[model samples]
Target: MKPVENAEGIQASLTLSYIQATVLKAKATLTVGILNGAPINIGIVGQADVVSDGKEGSAGLVHTDLLMQYDIQNDQFDAFLKATVKVIIAEAKVPIWLYFGANTPIPIGETAAEQKTRQSQNSNFDYYLYVGCPDGNGASRLGDAFSKVKVTIWKMDAGIVSGSLYGEAYFCIGSILPKFPPLPDEINKFLGYSTQSSNENSVINMINQGGSASGFMFGALVHGNINVDLAVIRAYAKATVGFDVALLHVTNPGSCQVGTSFGMNNWYAVGQVFAYFAMGVDLHIDVGLFSGNVTLAKLQVGAAIKAGLPNPTWMNGRIKIVGEALGGMVHVNKSMKFEIGEVCVPEMDPLASIKLIAEVGPGTDNVSVFAKPYVIFNLPMDNKPFKFNVMDKEGHETTRTFRFKVDHYTVKSEDNGYVGQGTKQFSADGYTMTLWSDEAFREKMKYTITIHCKAEELINNNWQKPAGKSEEEESIAFTTGIAPDTISERHVVISYPINGQNYFLKNEFKGKKSMVVVDQRNDKYFKLENDSNPIKKLTIIEADGGQVINTNFSVNGNDILFDLPGSLKNSTTYRMYFSIESSKTQEIKTTTELVDLEKTAGTGTVSMADVDFSTVSINTSVNILGASGSGNAIQSPTTTSASERGIRNKAKQEQSHRDAIDRFRKGETPVMTVINEGIENGTVDPTKIQDGTTAQGKEVAVYQPATGRIIYQMILEPVNLTPSPIKWLPLEVS
Candidate 1:
């Protein structure tokens, strides 16, 4: 391998086969070699360059014209490299060919000018090294003879056929970095390495320990972060290149996991903190022939993490179980029902972190109806489940009673809304509920949320059919009551005994009557067998004589004002009774009946139809104050006005009676007057007064129809009565 003067200031490819090379400061350390049947020490390969003065007449050459010849003084040889070769016959250590830069082929018997012309065009070569011989000589050639020796340069290309390119990715083991030192114990264990040289990872050890060993080959760089100017590249086949590329080597091996199952090898983030690569970038591969190249392929590694708890605000979530500490234990005291999938239960340790992992739909729409204040509730199938031990951070079980509260609530349905009057539609698909610890510092608290999914379709919908009974046990939702028609008249207003001692009365009619009210305001009801709000029972009694009427009457919404027949005597009271049939039951027995989907179209989600007449019937009375047949009408009390009926206040009237009695002794007894003037105003306090005293009186107001003016009111004579006790006998209870 000899080169003449033309090849100067040029870089060359140092082709080696079956070897490993490492990048070190923009240069390469070629390891492993076979030359002259002996391994060679590592040598440096520099980028093609030269040191020369550009002035002409220096060493009889200019920078552009040859640079130097073989002729040199002994002093000059000290500063400059020798361009001459000393080849002694039958001797070793004799200087042979002194070569530099790329090995330019000088054709056999070719003239210097012809070789120069070829070098200016395209002189092919593979590597350049000085071919040396020993200076110890058996015989030496004449200086002129050695100087006139011609050379034949055979190019190493045109003989190459096929080859491959390869790349290997590695990183620094735990304690030691990727360097020429003993590998770490962690890397040795991972690679099944035992002793120094008798291990499966010896190839890596050899490469690291023998860093300077020669004969190692390398590939051309396609893409890399190495600090070197990119080299000009060409395909080895030179056929047609750049189609669907079949890579023979890794392009970015640092970021890629190639042909390895390391991901499933139970690697934890323990010993190793960072990753580094021992990439064989720009490695040359061959199949006993030509060398092929590969780009810079990368390989990467990361842990497959087991996630934790989901966001607490999400409508649904799952509990992530890390280790199998609580093996096969099911502790589900709380539950969340999602709209999809099988009910999943997660078992975890008692003191695990309770963060939640939930996959929630983008935004949330809470559709929960609390039924009443303090009674928190939510819709079905709109929740996520998270599980954690109910133990304190110190490993003690905590039984703190916690309540779920509504952080957000609204009708999230896109399709439903209130229409007209009292009609609103529930147009949402479902609802949401976010349960949190009601305790202080609840944000720091963590509880295992167990998801309770309903297997029974009817149960999830709020109705549960009784075991033996055909009726279903239901849940009810009470709504805000509507406005009454008249101030004193409310059909849907009712009050009855709750705890047996005191009464729960409708506020509107609490003092107006004796536990009097019947809520018939809901003109609509569940499976109502009749017209709008039909009455199931009605009984009337003329209280003055205990005469009962036939069970027949018309019931309309809030018919609080009614009149008896005109034949009824003055001051006579009539008691009216109203009830539902159970043989006609009006009340909605169970709360669930209100929320059954089959019953309500999602709007009227509640029913209060159960009127339990088994305890006490609701009743009220009206008095026929004054009825005019056709004659003087016998001036009597009218239900129209309290002041006009002569039944002013029970206490005032009784005091007036006692005053009249005192005056009776002096012949000055006062008679009660039924005033006609106040009757037309209808300002009546209809409170009943049973005082056992009656004073006969008459009130007459003769009005002229043409002028519409009251003429006069005549107060007639008065008659007083006394109370008497009746004797009674008890019937036997048979």
Candidate 2:
């Protein structure tokens, strides 16, 4: 071999000429340290062929040689170099005689010509490889011939190594020399085969920079009763680098075309290099979760039916709906949806499609070996993915697109089911994949996520076994939307009129009679009978400033009502409140209640199941308008005078008309009767009678200021009286 310089000009080389092919025996000519003497080159030149046996095939040059460089001042062949030409494996760490041969230090300032003359015309041992232009300019074996010189060597299975063995005087110069070589097949594979993709900063290369062989195997794993048919090996580097991967089939295992033998004997089926940036995701699957299917990530290996061969028939393919999230983790406990042939592997740059690798070790029920997959890195971005529509919770469906990251990432449910059991999965960061199946999808929302996966598993290995789900997880934060709306309707008193007056109290409810609001909008609010019921607030107050409300009120259909304890006072005012709420934004939150007042106050208390209140009351009295006739007065002067509070004499009655009014307003319908028993036959005067009905429906009393008399009355309705619209019939009036 010709001598070569490293990055630094330290140079060394060894030439071997093979004499026998069968045993790989050859003659090796070793040379070193020609740079030390400059024009006066100095080093060893063994003219005789050194017979070495290691000169071919894999372990080239299995031999060693010790060559020494001489320094006249140190005088005893101070520096030495030993080369172990090659080894069987790529790496070896045996100690060799790499330092100088002796610890002798020579004095500076000695030049080769000066040293030669100073040592007497003939020094012990001096040599020359070639004669230069003149006597002093020959390739001489004199270390001091030149200062600051370097020597380097190169060989197979090891890389370039350089350093120097140099010296100097007042001009103290240093030497550095490192030997260089053909790096092992394991080392410079990238420089040999790796390259950049079209995309910016993208690269494709092998992963086993420390391994001796090429090509990888993809296989499936089987558990007790399940066949883990899906798995993916991918390449992902730090940032922005993606891959355009392909499966190069090797008829025989070895480097593509390393040895000349490969070019002649090995057959390779080069596949299509797909779009880039695809990666493998860790989907944790297990048989314990019978509801969900397994994938290439973490899934329990199912038991196998067929154990041997290229791949077992037992490995099952699982169909799953995998989600593609941003670079961060996403919890997958969402509704499961599916679209065949859809793959969802989120990446820096997703691929246009995914392809699976072939089986290498075949599937085994009991995995005996650990998997060591080749993970390539620094790939480029890829082609356009298949786009389709996906539905959101808002009932809006939008189109999405995906690409292939791994060529062999196929997994389907038909082949990878859990004993025919199905499931809904819930996975979030910070949590393991838990399969939750609502055989009925009970509380789960029905949603579908589009999945894009490769047609097969992409790996080549002898072993595939189940991996437990990762407990190390991350949390996916979510903002809960508004709770499902549940509000039936709200009711308000639009206009409640009594005695020809209107009370438009929406939030306020005040009325003497039952308010029957007959409208088409009765049941406007949602009752949400299927959902949880919400609490409602109601407040009713009388003009006397007393609260009147009770839970005992009954709800008929959708109408809300509270039975009043007593009638509202004639001129008194009252207030009412109605409020209800369900969700944050779904309810009768704001309203108004206005009441028109007509009042005269007297307080009275009423009781109920949940409320107690005092209400206003009105009193009425009747008196004689004219003096009793003298003849009739003297004749009737037998009992008592009119000095008593009511009259000259009081007569008892079953119940007064005021009592009837109170009963009717208290959620009751009262009917009253009146009998005429005042002077029916003797001296009947028209002036002595009073009307029982008044302008406000009916009257309860009559008064005569001339005699300070009061005639009691019975509450009456229009229908109970004669045709004059609440006209009362009386015997006569004086």
Candidate 3:
């Protein structure tokens, strides 16, 4: 052994020699102080052997020792340095005391030379090895000294220990011994291994002192591929005025080689050191720390699925068009090539792609344990009701089965029904799917939808099951939202003239018939009908103060037909009213506007207007029959004188004309017939029957009004009418 002094203090080095094949274990204890003064005994163990480093053939002897330093007060060892070594070799089965440095502490203020020579005279102990090892003589015995001792002692096992002790030592000043091994907390202060450095004042201070405290794992002591920055260790060593003591005080399991056994064996020591030193932390051998598929952090899969529209929708029929959204959390294990390998969560067939929502931490190339993934699918339509069943890889039913039904209606018949009563299996290959419904859908009156899901079905992009309970659940049901008070459409009067004359009231059916001139458009009367029909009690009213006229009426293919009343003034405007009763009552009415006579030649196609025409008397006469004509006046007496005969003849002619006009006022088509007969027989004067033309293809009469106009009214029943053209059907998008 040789002792040397440096800027900090003095340190010494020594070696313990043993027969390689015979030695099983070894330990050493040293007691040193100033000669002839109090001595301090400090215990330490030898953990490494040079014999393991291919040095076993040095004259059949192997040397072993540990490189270590102890901080001793300079005043404690003044001049004559005294030390002794008691070694126990497993093969020897005995203890040998090897005297080295002089014993006892020098009195304060004594020089090294003075103390050394003074102690040499009084102390009998010398730097020599004693023979004949004692049996448990303790550390106090000096044994027998000889000029040269060739003692062979048996070695002993250090024995496996449950806990470990670790610490550092400074070179001189025995009282300034290295602090008890820094637990992980204190280590974190220098290494910043347990948490973020930005928040740790100790770590920040370390960095500010021109050193980084990152890249260290405080969970365990590691060698070889150690997770530590050599530069940081150097910086810490400089600041603490001492080197780090990574040594583990554990039993040395034999066969440890510096070149080949650095990893596993050293790791064993590291684990024990942590298990013993890290307060309150339960430590164990973590196999994952050395695996290729280690999980740096976990963005666990969830057993819950969330919907974009979690609430019931008013547009249930349009759900397919609206699309549904679903998703969960996922982690990209960077160590496994940015994939969550099968060892953790395996990828399944259904997931299409993944989007890294965000990085779980600051490093982009590191594990993204907090990322998110989403799935969106637009529903498809079919001719039958929809049913979706969810299952697992084992073919067992996992999630509940979803169901949907679509009800439809036809405009003409107002018939309503639903399609599909059977079940259909769903596929798990994708997030998108086809939803069954009636392709005949035009307008949906009502509908409902059910969604199914199992705790296991709600997996991550990797199809990994969540770390939660795999509970099975029933379907979630959602129905259509509240319907509006009334249904409406764009319907204009499909009859004659112009829209100026076809302006109907909103929310109802009503309008004027003036511009609808006789024998003009549609051959005679103004008419109106809509998508909703089989309308009843269709009647016309003179809004400008005129009674309902008696007119011919009929219905032909959704059209309400009637005669242009002769009594209706040419410029006068009128309103019409009607109703439809089918589960609900719909009263239709018309609005009055001046007849655009100039536009009477144009086809009327205007935005339909309607008003809620209140319920009117349903018992009103549907048709008003014209009254019979008065009988012809009697002829004057034939026996009268010439003056009396002329008077009688004129009186009879006047009475005959009046009877014909009376019939015409009653809207009787026979009135014109009687007039023509009078003219042919010379009983009615030619000039009395002013010229008037009847509608070319009509059997009705158009007689000249010498004085007053006639009133005409009639009603058409739809029971005998032809089928309507408008057909209402339910429709679904996509």
Instruction: Provide TM-scores for the models.
Output: 0.18, 0.14, 0.17
Worst 10 residues of 3 by lDDT: 312-321
User: Which lDDT value does model 2 have at 363?
Assistant: 17
Q: Write the per-residue lDDT of candidate 2 for residues 133-196, one digit (tens) a residue.
A: 1112112132323211111222222122221221111111011111111112222231222222
Candidate 1 lDDT tens digits, 1-734: 11111122322334321222121112222332222233222223322112223222222111111112221100010011223222321111112222222122123234668645553441221111212211111111212111111222211222222332221111111111122222233333323334522222222222222221112111111111222222422222211011010111111111112255211231211111111122223434565876665433322211111111111011222221111112224222222223222211211122111111111111111111111111112332332331222322232333322111122222221223311111112213223333221111111111111222221112333444322212111111112222211112223343221111111111212222222233333333222333334344434445454555434223343222222322322322444443333333433322332221121211222222222211111112212112221122122333434222223233332343343334333433322232443323322111211121224343222223333433221122232322322111111111
TM-score of 1: 0.18
Total backbone clashes of candidate 1, pairs 3 or more residues apart or in separate chains = 71
TM-score of 2: 0.14
True-structure lDDT of candidate 1: 0.24
**What is the C-alpha local distance difference test score of each model?**
0.24, 0.25, 0.25
Candidate 2 runs further than 4 Å off: 1-400, 403-539, 543-734
lDDT of 3 by residue, 52-82 (tens): 4334332112343322222132211111111
